[model samples]
Target: MTSETTRKKTTEKIVVVGINHAGTSAIRTLLAQDPELEINAYDRNSNISFLGCGIALAVGGTVKNPEDLFYCDQVQLDALGAKVFMEHDVLAIDTQKKTIRVRDLKTGREFQDSYDKLVYAAGSWPLDIPGVPPEKARLKNIMLCKLYQHAQELIKKADEPEISSVAVIGAGYIGIELAEAYRQKGKNVTLIDYETRVIPRYFDTEFTRLLEDDMRRAGITLALGEKVIDFAPSPQKPDHVGQVITDKGHYPADLVITAVGFRPNTDLLSEAEKTGNGALIVDGAMKTSIPDVWAVGDSVAMYHAALDRHQQVALATNAVKSGIAAASSINGIPGVTVESMAGTNAICVFENNLASTGLSEAAARELGLPVASSYIEDADRPEFMNDYGITRIKLVYHEKTFRLLGAQIGSHGEINHTEVIYFLALAIQKKMALPEIAFTDVYFLPHFNKPFNFILTAILKAIGLDYEAAAGKSLERRPSLEGK
Candidate 1:
């Protein structure tokens, strides 16, 4: 332990450099646990710890008010004895002196503050196209839905009855969700992706076909296998028209939402190098290369066990975990060691739900693992209750030992985002065998589920055995295969 860690002060001054789900929740939880720690948070935006992810949902009319997405309020944080500094931009960090230089964005005044420990959950920023005219960013129709303020503007402009067509760039989760939202709002939504298919990073070709069909059914136009070369105002309509020029063709658009992807907010930490295209390299405890300075959230490069290297997993769950891990390490508490964190995430496609955990049919094969997978679409609940929903569950396992490797689920079931999905995520991460999971006493109820849910059933099927026949494979196997 260092002298700083051992010092018994009345209150340990801890400063968090950003405000988002990962940073805000971590700061609040840490202060709650350690009352002796004084928490100071810095966010340049007026709305700190806002639910930027739900902006699309708000535009889709799922959320009534923009305030519904803001998780942390000043009243709540002040009650927790936190000094929440809004509109404060952290400019630089002097790690050696344990001081941070910050400026008030509104007033342009600068100040330096010292901290016992520093946490950089600086979060992420939307990536913009290079050499794109800066004036294009100022265009009335050009949009990048990122912060709460940006979403508010998009909502205001989209609500206008005159705005009819939208062009969404990039086919990642955010882009897909936003496109769906705009289409739901009765706009002609065109989704453009450089890849041949949408969600190419997560889904296999077959599964992507299913999702593509779903999007088309939802009234979204797909311009796949093309690159958006440039954006210029429409030649026909000088005042309001915008053109999306791609390698293949040019399409007219009333507005454009760029969801190309995000890069980690790590420019302030000049000493730390990138671990990947979108993240910072960190140790097991979330400590950066700089001492007494730690990083988490979408900004840090995480250890991916399946791929066996440090990479970025830009998801809310991992960000929150990384933040909490950094806090615990600072407090000298033990954390659950993780071999890999690439797990399932749930996406709401209107009434339908798409969820996946670990490697998909594509990611597993791309790693060159000799694997076999099964996709089974079955009922999740009893038909007697008039409750029938389809769950397409896929499980991938090694052809030899039948050791569990990866899982994905696509369904319109009501409980798709319920506890069962989270359990499967944990199961995949732990590398639980098929038989063990199949025989496990999962909760049962008529409205909820049956004894052996579709996830376990699918796992058993992947191992080439029925649920009943796979009951004792854990004991039958002479050796275990994990992290090898």
Candidate 2:
């Protein structure tokens, strides 16, 4: 009789897998807009919505409480009319039947549920060290930084008197951050990575050299370009890893943390279309190849606006964006287009803040793009200011068209380097050229910046021009214009 009752009767039942960044965001977005929809979300992890990035800060005592890392829980979801299921793993999915078989970890009970639509946001899991027996790899001292529980366990182990040395494998963001965290706790930290440099994926040689110098100055050991062979157990405690055996040699490691990388958790969707790395392939609307099944988050491959292809970028920003897009498509919202990601990312190391967007120079070369790059080092603020600090910037562009490809920013001071990259990312998305940036209208002040913005200076340098000379000519004509 009532419109509300009619809508409820026709409401679609949606099932969401995982309760991490993407899954939770999709549920929240759908619930806020559509009260007529029935939603059920499942996650095997006991906790939901854990800030994986903040785990390092927590381990380093920057975050005093471990509980602070979690921002959402089951009770909050339940209040929002979501059928929340924690510690429940979806064993298998029957896309044809629109049903999923789920098993309860607590009660060991299994059941099947049907849905009109399904969203996959299972995220990723850390890759285990290869060639090691499962039993040996399960050593008490061997740790991971992927989950909040992992951070808790790592902190507990770090407090042990016998755990005086720590060996971190892989030199990506997580590896470097955890190494710094353990080092700050007064533990002898050795960082091992097959790559010759630190954060090679995000930064160039100059920025990485500065980070390496900072790490070594803080008494951290570097084992670059060495392959980890195996973990040797302690003579006294066979259940714990005592040393890390690499291709070069062995080093005492009271505890070992592997940050090698993460692989998308898409085994359940083996029959579905996926990228070579197992990331689910989805269209702009976050729709997978199968009808009524959508995917998002780290488990899905997104279109790279700069590269003009689909690639997997595991970041909370991408997760949230894709999640909203999927929910919007389901809710029949108009004009909700999924923007292509430029892989915009930022991280702080010691005193330096580094950020990058789009493709790097190396990435462009690898893709066989004819590109040119310019690097500039300038003061973040006018030299007249005492708070002035150096900022290094690098921009990559198409050689002929001058189309912006990517940009990287690094600064030693408290200046927001990420904001610079954010603007560059937007420019890349718009396919802007170098000349556009050179004459771009930007605010200026002596205390905050020079008359000419650094971005403009960098573009001028790339085009074989000088901003200083241009400024001088403008100043020389200022007095004559005033007389008129």
Provide the global lDDT of candidate 1 against the true structure. Answer: 0.76
* Tens digits of per-residue lDDT for model 2, 1-484: 9998898889999999998999998998899889667999999999988888987888788999889888788998888899999999999999989999999999999999999999998999999888766777777788888888898898787677788999999999999898889888999999999889998877777578888888898889999999987888999898889999889979899999999999999998878888889999898889998899999999999888888878899999999898899999999997786767799998887767899998888878988999999887777667667666667788999999988988998876466656878789889887899998776678888877877666877788788786666656432332111111
Local accuracy by lDDT, each model? 0.76, 0.86
Off by over 4 Å in 1: 1-10, 130-138, 235-241, 336-340, 381-387, 413-419, 443-453, 466-484
TM-score (all chains, Cα) for each model: 0.86, 0.94
lDDT, model 2: 0.86
Error of 2 at 213 (Å): 0.8
Best by lDDT: 2
Worst 10 residues of 1 by lDDT: 475-484
Tens digits of lDDT, candidate 1, 91-165: 998888999999999889999999988899888888886656666555667878888888898888778887788
Q: What's the TM for model 1?
A: 0.86
